[model samples]
Target: MQQTVPPPLRPYIIHPYLRRTHTMIKKRIEDDILIVTLENGRDNSITAEFYHELKDIIQEANSKPSPKGIIFTGEGRFFSSGFNLSMFLSFKTPREIADFFSKTEEPVLLDLFMCSKPVIAALNGHTVAGGLILAMACDYRLATPNPKAKYGMSEIKIGLPLAIAQGEIVRFGVADDRNYRDLVYFGKMMDVNEARENRMVDEVVEESELIPRAKQLVSLWIDNPGRAFTPIKRLLRGPLADRIQKGIDELDWEDSLKCFFYDDVRKTLEFVQASLNK
Candidate 1:
């Protein structure tokens, strides 16, 4: 789908607060909230570098005394197409895939989900698969009213099983068991309205309102979110995080990797991999 988060009607404030760019993330502080825009090429496919940068940003925001909430948005047509299909295709061995997933991606996702400060996804475009997984970790999500934008966890269709962090975040975020099954097992990508109904996003606003609305919502719980909100959030989600960590600790990557590489899975992945080139 052709879409772009309109050139910020209000250009990002860069003078008073820091404005910085990395390989995959564009960041600035506005109204005391961190505005993080995914800036990798067209689709903002999550790469290892992207995870590192995002994890660093989360650390920096969490370390601050006043606390900084985050608003994650997107550039161009995709909030993110999820993990880069190209990167997965480049994995020559199951060990490489296991290492890439178990070591790098999981830890970063865990950090984001367990962050003390509040986080919101002000989606500027379509979010799917692992990208939506990241969004589900946020405290709240607001998506633009982009007619073509879709949202869902598509990993099942791509022949990957949800890891601990992924499964819990999705389970914790979805409204009910049926929605969970529809998104995870069925791999059905829903339009923005359907996504809201499925609890993938909390609200849908016009494209121009995404950032402003996100900021307003953050402003409400803006003060000492790390102090007040953290405990409450932990109270609600601590067990879930612990469960995910436990699963991660005990997971047999070899077995998981083996399950993901069956003949049908490989063929499907190869087909999707080829589509990326087209």
Candidate 2:
């Protein structure tokens, strides 16, 4: 006999805020889990603006009376193609980049680590670089079995070190130091099987089943019903989180770092894109 998988539950209402921002990142409650959808037709880049909105939404989720969980997923086909290269190239100074990242993103990462709520990631498609880091922050990651789905800490491929905070999260998420090094250092995109084998993802299911499985997984935490889940998670994750936070505080001129300067990355990416187009 074979098993059947359930379909994803579509949120009744998808709210969009702040028309100024190109991306429409929104949060809604489904049962006990807060579903935060990263929806911008533009590759779902994580700009400082996105983090500001995320902080506001997460704070709201925390304020709710019921036990809480989070489900992070992309709006369309792409989970995220990673940082928007065009955005990366627009930085005028490293200090600006550093300041933007440290001030906006660090707090969000800390919030995810410290939040009493359990988070589940629905990897609907390819997840790259910082995007993958966002998914890894969650307590559970459910990926699609599609061969096209790739996930990795690919910052090194563009001459940047993965953010200290992101690296630390991946480290703790995988639970094995060696596998973490291979995945982070190689900066290579891994298929679903490779991701599952390396412990980058908790489980892989059909694309249509990703969200429901995520909800089911979070339900277990909601059912367990206590601080034990988040408490133990934070406890085990405390040291690494502290280390990353300290590193972020110490970073200088991070925004201006040539590693992510658009020109170089663009040139490199053009060849890759051309090859893919071939």
Candidate 3:
């Protein structure tokens, strides 16, 4: 008997925050799994709108039980390059830039980090900066074996310190002290082998195997009896999630503003924007 695939839950995602006619996330269900793919610009840079839609999807997934699990991937060569460099340029002043970042920090990543349905990241390519945060939020991450793919957080290079959610998630994801320092302090963009060795991702698979492998892992997690995974994960991650949100609520953004407008940092941001064009 042929199984009928469920129609897409959100063919054209719309939300009040997004004033435009389009959304960057593409959603569909296959084999009862919610597959969310980032179809943003060339590098799949994270944007305010992208975060909003992703949060809405997570909320919808948690508010029901039909999809069973979720897999987040990218459309093309890059899984996500993290924050779009040009976004910073869009703001005219340090305060404006800081405010924008603050408004976007409604703990979208934390929502993913605490998703009720098991989540997996099928990283199609480069996963850096905020991209790393998104991957780290998932229960498991499988990076594609693409030569052009790179991973890790390079925010420090441009003098951006980890915000509340970014820092806590990185801390929660890894237990080794040395590894944590290497990630936040050095902030290098690592290749696939180095990424694996440094534990940026759970495993590396070929392009064809990436989505399939994510689905397989999600099945293993969701197949357990009695839906026990949710509470168990909560038991493990709840306190940290609580702490992160509390921090967000109290965040003032002044320090981050300083980092954003530091002369050297502004120069570096320009360099990043230039690099994207090249």
How much is the lDDT of residue 135 in candidate 2?
Answer: 82
Task: State residue 28's C-alpha deviation in candidate 1, in Å.
Answer: 1.2
Write down the lDDT that model 3 would get. Answer: 0.77
lDDT at residue 45 of model 2 (Cα atoms): 63
For model 1, the local distance difference test gives 0.78
lDDT scores in order: 0.78, 0.69, 0.77
Question: How far off is residue 49 in model 3, in Å?
Answer: 0.4
TM-score of each model, paired residue for residue:
0.87, 0.81, 0.87
Off by over 4 Å in 1: 1-22, 224-226
Candidate 3: which stretches are off by over 4 Å?
1-21, 93-99
lDDT of 1 by residue, 63-182 (tens): 664345888998999998888776666666777777766776776787788776779999888899989998999999999888899898888877888888888888889899888987
Query: Which candidate should be chosen as best, given lDDT against the real structure?
Result: 1
RMSD of each: 9.5, 8.3, 5.7
